[model samples]
Target chain A: MMRLDNTEIRIGFFGALAVAALATLPLFSQGYYLSLGVNLMLYAALCTAWSLFSGPTHYISLATAAFFGLGTYTVGLWVDHVSFPLLVLGGGLVAAGLAALVGLATLRLSGVYFVIFTLGLAELVRQIVSWTQTKVSTRMGLYVFTDFTEVHIYWMLLALTVAVFVTGWLIGRSRLGFAMKIIGNDETVARHVGIDTARAKILLFMISGAFIGIAGAISAPRYAYIEPPSAFNPMISFLVVIMALLGGTKRLWGPLVGVIPFTILFDQVSAQFPNHTPIVMGLAFLAIVYLLPDGVTGRLEQLRARMKRPREKLGEEVRA
Target chain B: MQIIVTGILLGGTYALIALGLTLQYGVARIMNLANGETFVAACFIAFWLFTAMQINPLVGLVIIAPAAFAINWAIYSVLLKPLVDRAKNRGMLEVDSILATFGLLFLLQGLMLLAFGGSYFSYTFLAERFMILGNPFGLNRVVAFVAAVVIAVALYWFLYRTRHGTAVRAVAVDPNSAKLVAIDVAKTAAFAFALGGALTACGGALLSTFYTFNASMGVVFTMKALIIVIMGGVGDVRGAVLAALILGITETAVASLIDPGLTIAATYALFIIVLLFRPQGMFGRQTT
Candidate 1:
């Protein structure tokens, strides 16, 4: 146990270093690539947050976007009225609270039913927004200064993304993270050991929501506008999930590691084909599910595990 | 008097849709969330045959059914077979199939857009329109209703009586054991996928006559199919049929009674309520 804990510490330290280096990407990245890096950090944060609660438990919580939309709407609503930082923080808190309530009820379900309920909830939320808009005046638009380049907002999102990653890493290494992992692998065993399964799940939901919300909040400010479709769409949820799974679910820095390359690939495809963005998304998901079930981070871990084996490993170590 | 008649007309079409979901889930035990994609695919196919080839949409149902079955079988063999272990002790998380097939949904949507454009298409061959009962139901809807009933009955017979159908059922119940019994589990699953595909293609035939459709129609049908599948017990074809009727009526009634915008919400609201009370489903086995 002690040795395992130490290993987590070492890996986590490296992860922190990597995250910090990735966060400062704008300092050196070119204009087009800088935005790509910003997107990478943001989605990585969202996916990692999603993995905290749903990934481990095998719950497949589909409402990960509820908080994201909340965050988006929160920032869109508050940007004109309050400071940007406060709006972002507020988005996080609101998303966290909403997630808490949703997780408290919906997360109690398992498997397909859980996925369906969360989908219905998202649709319900979208419809509610749509319905409310019809009743109200034409002033429902998310007003903002149209000309700002969003560079500052990008930096702000990067910091929050790094902060969330660090915080998630800390929790993931803590006793609580272990408890969640235990529950994730098998709730029956976790219960036998006296881990409060419900509480652990709720904790994950809150953590995930806050991170996703922070992402949405910061992203909305960057765009200077928010809409129902963009905020609540399953596309965003699927993208984050693909990133987390692609990077390696359950790993602290998996999202950051996964999102950067994935974003670069996505940017390249979009740059080349222009209209083939969905094709890339579709192909990315297909490849991840088909060719690499464990994901990139998963592959890395297996390689690491293989390398840790004695004399045979030493002979093969030169391959890397 | 007319509500019941209208409900039955709507129910038949919905039942066919639900049957598509049931066949995949029951036989292969796979949740093909993009089953509606087949419906959309078939619609596009029928449109192509009718417009480009000068064939009537209804007349082409014969070709479309078998063709759709082949397409469905091919997709499973190509895409899904590669993903799954297809061996004993390998029933892992099936969600990957959902994601993979869902990718197909988006891919198909884009393909259809590229090929047919985003505009709605209606078969010019659809000339028959008449009333049923007091309500102004169309003749095409009646044909769809008859087709749905016949297909459901035929499926019931197939599953219960036929050798291949039994093999499919055995695979659903125990894939490994089915493999041991020389049932050719892969072929059975492929057949199940094809059967589901054929069923939706029939829906495509009905759709071309009843209503104009486009690329985006799949989402709504997918949602409605999901609700019907949930409303009906999982893997219960009969239950799915019944639940589809319940849903069709509930949706139609809610739309007529309240705001049309609230109709989708009504089904969801009902589902949320049902989930809280009966998570296994409305017709699933009673709690022990």
Candidate 2:
């Protein structure tokens, strides 16, 4: 019953093809290449999951690391007893539950307050986990034994990325997405128009948390050993944010576009100039913010519209 | 009793740091993520002065404060002003300013790291121990505490008694009304930023005498200042001081009573609790 636009159709087709290509990477690629693919997929999935809630609602959450870490620790602690799929689900549920609680309490605060609160929540969670590790386990890190091979992990990550991408696309087209756009543009106006802004925000926040948590859950086994510092590294939150913004948060495909190039950049920078990577990344971030505030996709969209305008004018003149 | 004394003393430094953030947020409505970095930069400056030039750390404040003011003024003029102007033209200033400041944070951190390699540095000056109320306290900490209190008092005086300070307050209270009254809102914002930079730098200079620090420690201090500012309420200077004192005491108490590793977590928990119960802050007026 719904009409699909030309752009949407092309995107859907290309998206499927891209996923198929990625799915075959594990079959052909080995060792470092497969691991690189997994890493790229992991970040792409995170950027997508982050943009799902933050892009539409305009709430810049720094809690991605918190949820991801929760999922990692959940898997780390319980992998022996539970099956892999159930552990993944459990990780998602736990993160969603925490997000729901945190959202209810902090969503009322807007702008910088929300950002700071989320950052604090992440730090708090990290410290608590660290404290627990020291107290209960007497060990600095947790090791999980997984029988899955590198290819299997790659497939799992690819599957998770697909799920996240699909969820993001579906959410973008749904009524909830419509409400979120309104809320992002103007919360007061959205509320006046009979939208329950708080409920919508909390739900979306939970959904975002669940996706990131699941990504963390599946990816945890790859590392074999997880420490609190690495598990809840705040840099993940910052990188995901930068990726989402760089790709153009307005479009569903923006993050993917942003992540591919940045992941490679990150890899190269970390390899060659490890200490200077922060400086390089920081400068790049500033350049993006100052020069391309709307991001790569937004700029491309503007260019397309500009090019189309002259043709449309010619068509009008001919008709006249 | 000793823990209480130490907490209050530590709170003095926090109050000084929070004062700078409070001024920026309250007056200019810029949530400066780089506030702590400004402090760290000043500390590094003082450290360089002390180590490289053999100058006393306290004396370095004379150079540090003015340099900090100029740097911050430049930041506002070059980076923030354009963004703020653009956002104002579009009528969406709040979110844009926040993002811009976030970018500025990374920029500052990166630059600091590049300029001064990541290594822990502390100023070794006036290192002495003295007994106070039957408890040994570091003389350097006592000096830092005293300097913090003096700076806070001076800031309070400036805010209450000076004409420029009144203008800053007026702009903070209502920019449109201040503009209607022929006050230059842009100039006021720049001045506020400069003043905030000086205060934070002074706080950093004082802290350098006592605390061990590195370039990456900026975010942690920034978080602490933010918590204090929020707990004290936006734009309420007195509340910021009170909140800082409360935080210092709470951290000390927690460290002493429980595990030391849990101190930061305890403070974050308190911050969350305050956010949930009193989002406007303890001393801020209610807003719908």
Candidate 3:
């Protein structure tokens, strides 16, 4: 077991405190805020789950929506026959299985090819689901009827977000995380150093898919009705990528930092100027990519290091 | 026979679009994710010109091509060049370019959405139909096919027979070696981007004459072009043409033979299979 650093301990403490505070929020808030909290938690979990693989390996998988959609469909098909928790776990396993198959086939390919393959994977899954629905069912969507309240859904999402966050933190402090970082830096060198780069990548890919799948399973019932388009929305994939990048994927808290402000901005902009929301969001993304390529957390780290330099020099001068 | 003819005709436009992508990605090593958006923007330009003025889309192509070339040149010089330079300095050019171009995709799409709302538009330029082998073919489709072939041939000639084309190829092969021969690497890159923009714009203009399209259509077109380019082996023009034909035929066959809803899925499956078996592409040099 790896020992925790001082910063890690403090972060853990504050993180637990934040989760406790958020868990109690539904008690004081009304329906609208509770729903908003649910959306926030959903996206937070997604972004964190995305960073689990793409952040470290820099592969830029565009198949998150594919796995998420698979999980939703898994629950949609079997929600009536199985227990809720069992269905959720089944959803995660299904996504993980698909990810493993895809990762095994495509992980050896580099650069744009890999990105395009992932994009195609999502589109392929969407098409298959749509086709199957048309051929097999009278309706294209499933109506989910449950007695779960708004607060109950909110708690579920919150639990998912916490689970994703802890997984991210643990991975960051693990030996696997070190290997992934090395691979991200340079795959060729990592392989030369005896890293099973492909195996590592495929493993991370499956892990990431499982978490996103669980998030999708937990969030699926909230929709009341789920269809191919809603379940496999490519926009969700893009948003997760943008949020994770904006927060600086190199750190554990990057996705959390990114999802909060961006989700609020998304809600506000869409509510006020629905037609122009894309333009607003697009411009914001452009600005972030150009000016803050390292993301908010990465930039803060730079600033902190810069500030520390003068203090270190002063200490050395006094010693001299 | 009808399906084959139709697929080949449609492949003409796909080839043109893939050619543009090959130039940007294969030759210049810049992954222009907004490639399809450029095509859509040109389509919109033609549509607006036709609707506002009595200008024919064919006539508007003259305006669209040059305008697109200039716009893309400016994008490369201003937005992408700095990022490329920095990535090169840091040795992360491939990944950085992908993200930067992805940003450009969103930027272009958003701007287009703001300018032209989510509505479908088509150029109703030649509404006549002619029968060939007992199959009714649109005059617009025939014209678009002819135009696509002519432009593709011209592009091939330029790349092979012209001095500037040779310089572009030289840079694509080895930038250091090209620079040693006094070839302006940066200028060639810019020119390639401009040419790519022009080709895709021309494709869009031709397609507008036949197909109804909206802003969101850019993403689909981009994916199709990417598939063709990957299949042809990045940067291989001849390979792109062949791959585009194959894809077009496959799509048309699937739509007619099996189910229309399965066309896109079929293409995606082909892409995955290709990546697994031959990631270097059909025409590319062996790398992986």
Candidate 4:
């Protein structure tokens, strides 16, 4: 137990050090590299936030785009009127509120129904936003001008990523996390065991929504302009799901493992063959599903177990 | 009255679209997200046939349907067979197939975009209007509607009157018991998936006769089809047809009465209400 605790502490220490090191990238790197760092941190935060709820519950929510867009639009609508930090906070709150309402109505649905409902929710929100914007203003897009540089956005995203990781870790150790694991394994059994599955799911989903919203809010200024199509793009949801799955959602840090490589690869592909980006993404998704069902971290764990098993068997033979 | 007539006519083709999705999800146990891409691919082919060879979209269906069937069969056999084989349970298969087909969606969409740039294509094939209840309606739409009805009727007859179709339905109901009764579950699933793909292609070809289409427009049809499938119940043919009309009418009403931009939002609103009130779908019996 002591050794396990010591290992946990060591991991926490090293994780902080690594993030701190990443925070210094803007000092040495400029232009494309700095922007790439920002992109990496943005996705890392989004994927981590997504996995916080979806990882444990086994309920895949594609509503990340909805919440993210709400965050983005919140910033867009109020960039001039509201302070930047206030807008970020308001964006997260708005997203969480929407999540609570949506969760109440749709969390009862299981399996594919839940998945489809969330997917529809994003599209619905986008349409409504588009319609309202059309009615309210002649211009469909809002331009956002802020004094914040790429460095500031990168730092904000990095901080958000760390916060999401820490929160996820804390949740994983809490009773709520224990309940969520039970729900994930078997919701009916969890319900039979007197767990309030709905409440648990809603709470986690709200937290996930809030984090996604904050990430969007932080990244909004970087775009300089926000339109309904780009802000509420479903590709964001797809990428987050693919990344989280690729990392293996079993561990808090798993999504980070997937996000880093995927973001980098996506950047390179889009830069080189912009028209074929979707094709590459599609292929990547198929490869990941077939070859790494358990994800990179999960595959690594299996390899470690296999390696240890042979050594343990040899030791038993020596004893015999 | 005008809205009702137009809605019903539009719904006829929508029913055909939804029917394909129902079969794919019901019998094959694969919720194919690429279903719309098949429709779009057919639309493109139909366009090509019309513009290049002066072939009618109706005649083009003869070529497109069979090719779609062959492609879907190959996809099921090569890509989805391994997934179905390895899946530990229904839920695992659902997740795996959804992810796989989601990838397939992007793949097909990307290919279509590459072949046909991001421009809307609508040929002047029977654009003449005819009177229907004192309202003018496109002749192409009426032809497409009639073709959809014929295909849907033929599908119905096959499912109800044939021995092979009985086995397919049995697999949809319960794959394990169907296997016990000597039905080849895998074979039936492959057939249903291919049939579904063919049906979707047919719908696409017919729609291409009248509807303006682009590569990315496939996802909209997909979402509309998905909404119909769920609202009608996963495997229920009659329910899908009914739900399609409901959707078509509602959308037309919303577009005519309210803002045109709110049509998608209205579809979602209805979907959410149905999901909240009756998760089993309109015609589906409650399962424990």
True contacts kept of each: 0.32, 0.49, 0.57, 0.69
What TM-score, computed on C-alpha atoms, does each candidate reach? Answer: 0.88, 0.96, 0.96, 0.97
In angstroms and one decimal each, the interface RMSD of every candidate reads: 2.1, 1.8, 1.9, 1.2
Q: Taking the tens digit of each residue's C-alpha lDDT, what string does model 2 give over B8-86?
A: 9899989988999989888877778889899898889888899999988778888998998898899889888887777
- Among all candidates shown, the one with the greatest TM-score: 4
What does each candidate score in C-alpha RMSD? 4.0, 2.0, 1.8, 1.8
Q: How do these models rank on DockQ, best leading?
A: 4, 3, 2, 1
User: CA lDDT of each candidate?
Assistant: 0.74, 0.86, 0.85, 0.90
Residue A206: error of model 3 in Å? Answer: 0.8
CAPRI tier of model 1: acceptable
Poorest lDDT segment (10 consecutive residues) of candidate 2 chain B: B88-97
lDDT of 4 by residue, A161-262 (tens): 999988998898889999998998888899999999999999999999999999989989989999999999988998999899999888888998999999
Considering only chain B, report the TM-score of model 1. Answer: 0.90
- Give the Cα error of residue B149 in candidate 3, in Å: 0.8
DockQ of candidate 1 (2 decimals): 0.47
Whole-model lDDT for model 2 versus the true structure? 0.86
What DockQ would you assign to candidate 2? Answer: 0.61
Q: Give per-residue CA lDDT, model 2, range A1-320, as digits (tens).
A: 77899998998899889889888997787988887888888898899899899888777789999999999989999989899899999999999998998888778667567788786677788888888878886789889899988788788878888888778777778888888989988888999999989888999999999999998898888879999888888888888888888898888878888898888888888899877766766766676768878889999999999999999999999999
RMSD (Cα, Å) of model 3:
1.8
lDDT (C-alpha) at residue B154 in model 2: 88
Q: Which pairs clash inside model 3?
A: none
